[model samples]
Target: MATLEQCMTALEGFVGDLAARPALSGLDRTVSCRLTDLEQVVQGRLVNGTAQGMEAVPAGPSVPRADIRIITTSDDLLAVTSGELSFGSAWASGRVKLEAGLRDMLRLRALL
Candidate 1:
């Protein structure tokens, strides 16, 4: 298990990388990462490959769904961001769950 702060830091680093990816260029979408272990969701917007205003919120119906949704544990999030676990492996093995539209999925494949 990882602490909320640790997860936030990991996500920040991950988003930093995401912002620099040419594959994500010109893509704009809202993203939510639901951390099952902490029962929290980190919400943010990806605008032209840059992450903006990311914040953690409680997970519940009150939270509106984002265009891109990711469900996983804090540990898995840490593992992926730290390169201890590959994103493709995590998604394939069910450690990570990604929900997005077909177009977004195709664009994201380059990131994996």
Candidate 2:
């Protein structure tokens, strides 16, 4: 099983590759992950085609930022990273929870 750091690294690589495409250059967003049963939260910003790690500060209210929140167990993370789990199917099956604004959700769908 991959550690959270390893999983994060993989995700970073994935996003980096995706951001390299000319069509994806303008994407800017924030993603927050609260791993199931874990106390740590990972927050980062994807801006101007680069993902910059952000301080793990609590989000303020009324901020106009597209936020993607994911809550899943460690096992689920492993499954997702290994391609053994499908996010759409997991989301539909209640294995994952996603909350986002409408436009954020749409942009996330396009990016992913």
Candidate 3:
């Protein structure tokens, strides 16, 4: 099992990549990543195709209301980062869950 720290690292790297994608350009939205197994939440915002203000916060609505929410386990997170698992497969298999508004959903589909 991966630790929460490891998951956070991987998530940051993943988000960094996502930030550079053209699809995210000019988008300004809050995103929350809720790690179920880790019992933690990491929050950030997308601005001009870059993620900013990302940090772990106590799990709750105290963080910004998310336009995109990603729910998954630490192990699965590390797997995806290490390429031992695919995001699409994990999501399809119910190991990963994503919640977002309709526009955000359409936007997220181009993420991975």
Q: Best candidate, lDDT-wise?
A: 1
Per-residue C-alpha lDDT of model 2 across residues 14-62, encoded as one tens digit per residue: 4465456666578776766565545445567767877678433333553
TM-score of each: 0.95, 0.69, 0.88
- lDDT of candidate model 2 versus the reference: 0.62
Residue pairs of candidate 2 with colliding backbone atoms: none
TM match of model 3 to true structure: 0.88
The reply for model 2, stretches above 4 Å from the true place, is: 14-24, 54-66, 110-112
Instruction: Order the candidates by lDDT, highest first.
Output: 1, 3, 2
RMSD versus native structure for model 2: 4.0
Shift of residue 85 alpha carbon in model 3, Å = 1.0
Runs of candidate 1 exceeding 4 Å displacement: none
- 2 or 3: which has the higher lDDT? 3
* Model 3 local distance difference test score: 0.81
- Write model 1 residue lDDT over 1-112, tens digit each, in one string: 9999999888877876776689888878898899998999998988886788889999999999999898999999999999999999999999999999999898788656
Between candidates 1 and 3, the lDDT winner: 1
Cα deviation at 107, candidate 1, in Å, is: 0.3
TM-score of the candidate numbered 1?
Answer: 0.95
Q: By how many angstroms RMSD does model 3 differ from the true structure?
A: 1.6
